[model samples]
Target: MVIAIGFEGSANKIGIGIIRDGEVLANVRKTYITPPGSGFLPKETAEHHRNQVLGLIREALDVSKIYPNEIDVVCYTKGPGMAPPLLAVAIVARTIAQLWNKPILGVNHCIGHIEMGRLITGAQNPTVLYVSGGNTQVIAYSNKRYRIFGETIDIAIGNCLDRFARVIKISNDPSPGYNIEQLAKKGKKYYTLPYAVKGMDVSFSGILSEIGRKALPQKATKKRKLDQEDVNELPSHEDLCYSLQETIFAMLVEITERAMAHCGSNEVLIVGGVGCNERLQEMMGIMCEERGAKLFATDERFCIDNGIMIAHAGYEMFRTGTRMKWNDATITQRFRTDEVEINWEVGKV
Candidate 1:
């Protein structure tokens, strides 16, 4: 019977979601899409969140058929995202909490994804592969915390894909990464790219640099301006996209498998924005099938950053007597997944 309202504007997306018990009543979001060849700036993304958050909240509330007073708690992403955007969401969340006189909980963005994935997929004690525009980590619950087994040493996997899409001038309507995924399906050639994996951690900046030098030469990028017809001498964007996905996803799967083996866990849960990628899921499924394990994932509705995740995670904490004081209701840009205190028992499922 716990009803919670969650606000999430950690990056470019502003999401307001209402959840009752473990089910998502409403999940509404709006993304700020920059033009092709440009990345979303934090300031602009924050402004977009500021402008659209109230409307999204109303939409979520209406869709859920719930009133503000009925909400037992209010939750918002506290960190592991861009500072300005996180702050914008935090402000709105605090305001609404005050107006409704409800308890507030600050949830970790990454853990929200993990908890939401578990709730939807019903995977208990699974090894989590969290991949997103801002984060890439292999995690598992240990010692009452989601410990990171592996992570990206440099830029995130999704950031690398997005930047590559910008270099190729892919459409940013649905998502730059989604556009790359579509083009990758048409790719027949497997152009080799750097596959970086140092122990459990991975690196993508080197691969991005190498691809920029080879498939997208500086001279060609400037002269042809990413025009597929004009850049006939270079490798096709499809090939680059395909190769990038193959290499990076292989690195992710390798680390996830290693973590699963180390933790003695057979269930694998993939969460976060990049978890929406079908190819990644297929690859993970293949690995899981070979290992006689199961893979858990969700569609884009729950995979990407959204408030339902925050609300779900927060409701769990709230149910366990975890509440954020008004003074402690703050946001951070570097909140790691392992930093949060898990109040609930881990073996519930």
Candidate 2:
């Protein structure tokens, strides 16, 4: 019966959410979108969070119909995100916790996605594919940690898409990745790009570099063909988007299947911002079907960075005797998934 309010601003998005036990009472979010051909920077993103967080918190409280005294705890993302934005949101969370006289818990950004995915989809002990702007990982529960079986060796999948959007001046209104996904839907041709996967690890820098060349004007790109194939001029941006999605998603599916096989798990759960793409879900669903397994997932509401996830993950830790003092609550820019101990029940979660 514990009530928790979570704050999240790990990247361009800022969100406030309130939950009672496992039921979501309020979930609200706002994004700090930059102009076309540009991505959000850490300082500006932090400023946006500082400006919007209090208002969003008020909105969450209003929607939840809960008094400040009723809140059992305040939760915020601790690390593995941009520094400035994470600090801004963490400060707000700590401030609110102090004012409310409640316990403050610092939750891992990646585990927030995994715990929220489990809560929303009701898929216990499934292999997790966490794809976000800042992270790309294939993980599963083993020995009480969300063990990383495979991850990006260089740039993350979402970061790769975001940078590519800047090349073609794609809209960043909803998101660069979302716009790219929409354009990919109308593509009718396939252009080969670099594929980099080694054992269980994958890399996106090569793929982004390869496709970026094709997306540019002929004069701007070097006169070179990848894989000894003809460097054909791209027909349209739509085709470029389509090919990019197919190539990267295939790499993801391949590694995810390998992890699934290694773990002997029949379920695959997709979590994070990139997980919202319908094409990725469709591809992963196909892979699961071929393996005679189930695929658990959610739409943008749960998949995208949101506060409910932070709160949910925080509660999971707080109830298990985890708490952070205000002075000791620190935000990090590079927290790994395997670093956190999963104290909550695994299959039962």
Candidate 3:
């Protein structure tokens, strides 16, 4: 039985998890919440991770009832994330591995999400819909790599939603997306927004720009303050939120279905931070039902970024004889999913 300790701080959340075999023994995370109308800065987020990561790691070890010497390997997310935050976590991970004298593995953030989703859902070779603040893509495993079948041309869907939330100054306590989803539930009208899909890819910048024009006053763009009367002059916030969710989620579902048909897969696995949105899951479920396919998703626990995923995927890599030398444990800011060689999946029918 392999025991792995994983660290993840690729973005605003800092997580420490311990896993035994395929089951998670402990998974803990702490997020840095910025005030309303502001987004998390990389420097500040990295500092937050540095400050809280050690405590989180200790807490995870205590919760799992495992000794540091019992850990077989250490894993950390290496890429496709904010540089500062990734570096902060990578430094900690390398230090721990050196101190414990354990093998260290660097994992791709995107592939970690995919592997964890498959492990949790028991979905065998399903088309993957990975949506997060930094990424949005429809992927399928082919030729020993997760190939991108569809992706966003501009900003990711989560970024679009978060920026829109900033326009209205929503709280970032739990999450901007979650707050938008709750507000969307109160919407009675559906305002039309721009929908852009070319072939299998989708675009959200245009949709965001169009929504801003309708939702904000002409002068509100320069200064993000709006009086109650000014707010009434524009479309209802709930309506805008509702319409945004419906429009973008429809695009996501359409692309995912296209990938399913192309790959001849009857199962769809959703992962990443935005995958926790109930509306997205509901839309994907409806689409899968129409096509006689299955939909697999996890709750917020695994849906959002966590260290367990890094541990799980890293363990798979370790089992396949994949290891990163101490000097080669550098992080990549633009690591593509297909760049990693997935040796573990070889010879599987």
Candidate 4:
């Protein structure tokens, strides 16, 4: 019977959601789109969030049909995200908390994604493969902590995909990664790229560099003068996209399976921006089927960064008597996945 409002602006998107208990009342969100071949910068992203925050908050409450006084607490993403964007959301959250006279809790962005996935997909104690632009990790719940089993030693999977998308000059209207996934479906040839999986951890920097330098055509003029051998060596943008996805996704699947084996868990839950990819889901599903396990995933609604996840996770923490003072509701750029204590793990199912 607790209603909470959550503010999420840890990246290019700004979202505000209202939730009652485990039910979503409203989830409003908007992404700051950049031109093709460009990524959204922190300063510009923060400005976009600040401009959209108040309107989104009002819309969320209006759509929820819940009054401000009825809301039990306000929650905002505290860290593991872009500082400017995160701080923009935090300032508004703190101001509203003070005005509304409600408690505020700063949520870890990664846990918000995980908790929301469990709530939506109903997967209890599943091995979580969290993939996003800024972070990548295979995690499991142990001893009241979302213990991280493996992670990216360098750049994240989503970052790799996004950078590749930029190299291919894909549109950023919807999302670079989304456009890359679309192009990948049309790929016919599979040019083998460097696969860098070191034990349970993965690395993407080398493969990304390799693709940009040799496997793909750099200039159109150079492409025209290519000999048969050179032409054969260079793959189409489609094939490059496909190879990149397959190689990276395979790396992710391997690590996720390793984590599952280590934990002896039969369920695999995929959550985060990159988790919205249908191909990745299909791949993970195949792996899960081979292992006689279940694959728990969600569509873009729950997979991409959104306000509902923040609100739902806030509710979980709030139910467990979690509280944050106004002064403590600060943002951090490097919050780790295993830092937060999972006190609300009593009845996970």
Query: Which ten-residue region of model 1 has the weakest summed lDDT?
Result: 221-230
Q: For residues 1-349, what per-residue lDDT tens digits would candidate 4 score against the true structure?
A: 8998999999998999899999999999999999999998999999999889888988998899999999999999998899999998999999999999999999999999999999999998999999999999999998888999999999988899889888878898799999899989999888778888898999999999988875555544643875677677666888888888999999999999999998889999999999999999999999999999999999988888998889888999999898786678899899998999988872353
In model 2, the clashing pairs are none
- Against the hidden true structure, what lDDT does model 1 obtain? 0.91
Q: What Cα-based lDDT does every candidate model obtain?
A: 0.91, 0.92, 0.92, 0.90
Give each model's clash number: 0, 0, 0, 0
Off by over 4 Å in 3: 219-229, 346-349
Candidate 2 residue 349 C-alpha distance from true site, Å: 12
Q: Which candidate gets the maximum lDDT versus the true structure?
A: 3
Give the better candidate number (2 or 3) by TM-score: 3
TM-score of 1: 0.96
Error of 3 at 221 (Å): 7.5
Return the lDDT, model 4, position 121: 93
Clashes of 2: 0
Expressed as tens digits, the lDDT of each residue in 197-285 for candidate 2 is 99999999989888877876555436553432233544589999999999999999999999999999999999999999999999999
- Scored against the true structure, residue 267 in model 4 reaches a CA lDDT of 95
> Per-prediction TM-score, please?
0.96, 0.95, 0.97, 0.95
Rank candidates by lDDT, best first: 3, 2, 1, 4
Q: Any runs in candidate 1 off by more than 4 Å, and if so which?
A: 218-230
Looking at model 3, the pairs that clash are none
